[model samples]
Target: MDATADASTRKPAAFIGRRLLSLLYDLLPVVALWFLAAVPFVLLDVAVSGDVRHNIGPFSLLQWLLWLACWIVTGLYATVSWRRGGQTLGMRPWRLRVVADDGGAPTHGALWRRYAVGMVSLLVAGVGFWWAWIDRERLTWHDRASGTRIVRMSKRN
Candidate 1:
């Protein structure tokens, strides 16, 4: 094998820490989005039930519906960012880009797949993230499943 060619294909090293930081950064926008998404839910609740929040103990149909709405909103945010630029608001400052496993811009289906699997990854206490430490290419579960990976971006001249 050509060593230079192999080295060029090797996964870049700046991924692990930046992944966590980018998530933290992304949370700001996701939270804002959730807040915005909540408005209609709350408005509907008030219109129907005369209360802003449900009285049921945390797991009502309304609660689940609201949760699903927030989840979809979050997914939409990620999918759009990855599809359009391979970088979310959070990914920008960290100089990271999410690309297909083949190093191309992620396709629409691939981006949505990443978002769905990413939701699972988050629900599972981030076992997906820990998987990176053990993966030869340092790919997280979502990274592997979605055929996507985060890459360290280089500065322009």
Candidate 2:
């Protein structure tokens, strides 16, 4: 019997399984960041005005800017890490990694494109994420658009 045959036959990580684990790993930190950003407004409303309604000052332009900043930070973290290391904090925990479909590290351009297109996918009701479940090759819409794939790293490899 070929020694490598058994190793080769092991199933790769499932899309849903990896995604679920990644979400679990990411949820706490992401939520914490969001809460930290929102807390100042809540405190201002309570401290100066004695009312929570006006805490963020009627959701003005500055408020929007803050929201955008938070999103950008999160997106940048995900994109840069994925491109540079092939894995985000969550993906690393699950031994799943992202790579170009051609089996190389993703270029910066590809990473940006993937991140931007991912927003579109969410706006359309997460069709991009769901794409992995139904895709013949198990590629998400963002993966397809960016020419990338997420694969499980074998223990030995």
Candidate 3:
């Protein structure tokens, strides 16, 4: 009997719990960023027309750009952090890690594929995100598509 190997094979439930916590942590920063971006439009309306009811067409373009930028920032954050550190800021706080199916740092290609698929999942009524809840293995569609897995990291051995 290989005791050490057996111990290492146990599932990481704590890590998953931590990962969920980290998602909440990350959400705070993302929402803050969204709010900051929205301020420009608010200010533009006040400064240009001095009327609350007035609509600024140029500001609308800026708002759209801000929205797009937010998505790009989020995707890049997830991809770069997951590939380099095995988790994002959110995942780290929760002590969750992401790895390739074979248990290694994901390649850039794999990260991008995961992000792209994740976007598609969001477009498709968020079925991909919800997949994790129903999946026996707790994997989302993007995770399966990218051959990635999210594991909970534990403090105690």
TM-scores of the candidates are 0.87, 0.74, 0.68
Candidate 3: deviation at residue 137, Å? 2.3
- Give the per-residue Cα lDDT of candidate 2 at 127: 83
Q: By TM-score, highest first, what's the ranking?
A: 1, 2, 3
Candidate 1 overall lDDT versus native: 0.82
Q: Worst ten-residue run, lDDT, model 2?
A: 5-14
How big is the RMSD of model 3?
Answer: 5.2
lDDT (Cα atoms) of all candidates against the true structure: 0.82, 0.74, 0.73
Per the 3 Å backbone cut-off, how many clashing residue pairs does candidate 3 have? Answer: 4
* Regions of model 2 farther than 4 Å from truth: 1-14, 35-53
Cα RMSD, each candidate: 2.6, 6.0, 5.2
- Candidate 1 per-residue lDDT, tens place, 40-153, comes to 867777787876565533767777888999999999999998888888999888888888866788888888888888778888998888878888788887787787888888
Query: Global CA lDDT of candidate 2, please?
Result: 0.74
* lDDT preference between candidates 1 and 3, better one: 1
Question: Can you write out model 2's per-residue Cα lDDT over 7-43, one digit (the tens) per residue?
Answer: 3653343476687578579767777777877776567
**Candidate 3 lDDT for residue 145:** 92
User: Which of 1 and 2 is ahead in lDDT?
Assistant: 1
